[model samples]
Target: MSKPYSVEQPERSAVDAMDGIVALEFGADWCGHCKAAQPLIQAALGAYPSVQHIKVEDGSGRKLGRSLRVKLWPTVVVLRQGQELARVVRPADEEEVRRALATAD
Candidate 1:
């Protein structure tokens, strides 16, 4: 359960192969919103067990966030077969997170 939520380091193949992937942009410990969204993201991942949940840091030196055009912290990007499906920027609560996940399908 806890294992799938593990962060996958930035790589081309890994990111490209995420068909039905849920990519989460989470910053370092200093980000308050990122921290706040962690639990909700975890729960969402738990519910969608088949979804590949990948966490990426949204701080300096992290190109992943910029590549994804993440303008806000704690951005949840959902993808289907490595394609951009839906996104939620700066989600406020678990319900929002759930809604985002629902839209991904």
Candidate 2:
């Protein structure tokens, strides 16, 4: 079986492998939308497997989410060379994710 793409505890060095990044995020497992979005995040991410796909739980009181100005669960942010390309809040279609990734430069 292929390795599951989800990372429960990501290291800083690990994320550097991606020339671009897609962050699918929320605060915790208790969120219904967050649970639903996981599979979509995984499948959509396959198209850009070289892009770093990161799932961040926003409410560990970590500064990352705050810095990103996350205001909702299931937010997807695309970044290239560590710079923001696009952001979607609760996207319903995988195409939006794909489109965002494709736009990365």
Candidate 3:
């Protein structure tokens, strides 16, 4: 089973300060695109056990989402040492997600 998006999100500053490779997946549980991408995201993430993945619940008035300018569902922003390396929005397949994750490698 896939994990549900968490409403308790870390501040953008905190995220920006994070160390190592991190995957910030911004989406909502009710979003179809988000749901469809879960498996692909998980499969790709499995190959990179060192990577930290944070599933964030996003919607209107969500500060983290707003600050990140997340306007779409299932935006996987891959970061390396707190800096953005790549992003894949609404990935169609595991390979797409893997490609985004590859940037941090």
**How would you encode candidate 1's per-residue C-alpha lDDT over 5-98 as one tens digit per residue?**
2344566456766656655545555577777777877876677777766666565656676677777777888876667767887777777777
Error of 1 at 77 (Å): 0.8
TM per candidate: 0.76, 0.72, 0.94
Mind giving the per-residue lDDT tens digits that candidate 2 earns over 1-105? 123224254443444345546554544566777666666666777888777666666664555665667788778777655566888777677787778777763
In terms of TM-score, the best-performing candidate is: 3
Cα error, residue 16 of model 2, in Å, equals 9.0
Candidate 3 lDDT by residue in tens digits, 1-105: 398999899988889888899899999899999988899999999999999999999999999888878899999999876678998999999999999999886
All models: lDDT? 0.67, 0.63, 0.90
The C-alpha RMSD of each candidate to the native structure, in angstroms, is 3.1, 3.9, 1.0
Cα lDDT of model 2 overall? 0.63
Model 1 pairs in collision: 19-81, 20-81
Name the candidate, 1 or 2, with the larger TM-score value: 1
- Ordered by lDDT, highest first, the candidates read 3, 1, 2
Off by over 4 Å in 2: 1-19, 22-24
